[model samples]
Target: MKNILRTAGVLAVASASVLTGVTAAQAAPSCSTARVCLYDDYWFTGTPRSFGWVTYNVGVDSNDKGSSLVIGPATDPASPYVYFYVDNNFAGNNVVFRAGNASNDLRGLYMTPTRNWDDEITSVWG
Candidate 1:
């Protein structure tokens, strides 16, 4: 009886470990095929601005400084059609925009070498 109980416990633990690994793997996002598209104009000013895109698999930190867009596998970071900004006018001086549950889209729209620009994000598409 004692041996049987120990074997059952080991099997239970092994099953749980396998299940947890599967869950974690499923939770991770794949950006291999994801792409983002961005428009060149802002809603308020309608001014044509040139913006670039970069792909980041790791999550964005709130304290980090720079103008960048965060995207997921379904949404390509290379093409950000929407313009989101983190400017100096906001309370925390940080802006985070979420598009879907599969991946979180972060836009550092207002980050400039000299200062931050508080502006509205025009549009976003995957």
Candidate 2:
């Protein structure tokens, strides 16, 4: 009886640990911490391009292809804002996203009244 009780307790603890891990995994974002991740599809469904505290043009392949983005903590504490630019080298129209925020869809985001951000992002900086 004593051995059985001990085994049951151990199993219960193990089960609880597994449940906790699963919950954490589901809640965590697909992107890593302290980096911005831009997705090609709405709702962050597509493979993301991650960026640190540098300027990236995203090249032609990723240019004008961003539809959503996830913002993480800044690489440096001083700069906690992320910028998405319509032109390379951080030029042209831009949008800002703060730390710990995310834009699941970019269709509704407009850099200007006439220009939507859905597929106009060509570069990123944070």
Candidate 3:
């Protein structure tokens, strides 16, 4: 799902066949290259769940719960965007982020006119 997007702070989204969830209270991981990491809270704090290429549902533990995001360089330069969705099965409103981007706070990125990307993501892909 595509919506009106904000240009500042350079936010990120998600997608992956392989995703890793870290403890929410734990500090964020390095995030590495060719990966997208979604944080439980703003400023890359709290829990962090990282992902690679392919689509994902974000699981029950992390669905609609992301507050920030970090993206690594794309493995495939031709497909360098990460996608975050508002609905399951890769449906509903969505945000697409470029590789190597990071957002300290997803709250500032608009997913819809009145709603921001923070805590509104249900699915993801790159």
Question: Which candidate wins on lDDT?
Answer: 2
Task: Say which candidate scores most in TM-score.
Answer: 3
Q: Compared with the true structure, what per-residue lDDT tens digits does model 1 show for residues 1-126?
A: 999999998888778768875433234233233433222222212222222223221122222322233333335444433223332222233334443322222232344455443323332323
lDDT score, candidate 3: 0.75
lDDT (Cα atoms) of all candidates against the true structure: 0.34, 0.77, 0.75
Model 1 score (lDDT): 0.34
lDDT (Cα, tens digit) per residue for candidate 2, span 1-126: 999999998888778768875433223365566777778887676767877645567776777888888888766778788888899889998888888888877999988888799988877777
Backbone clashes in model 2: 0
By TM-score rank, best first, the candidates go: 3, 2, 1
Positional deviation of 108 in candidate 1, in angstroms? 16
What is the number of residue pairs that collide in model 3?
6
Candidate 3 residues 1-126, lDDT tens each?
Answer: 144354221232221212433233333345777777888888787888876656468788888888988888888889888888899878988888888777778889997689998898887787
Error of 1 at 26 (Å): 40
Error of 1 at 7 (Å): 78
Off by over 4 Å in 2: 1-30
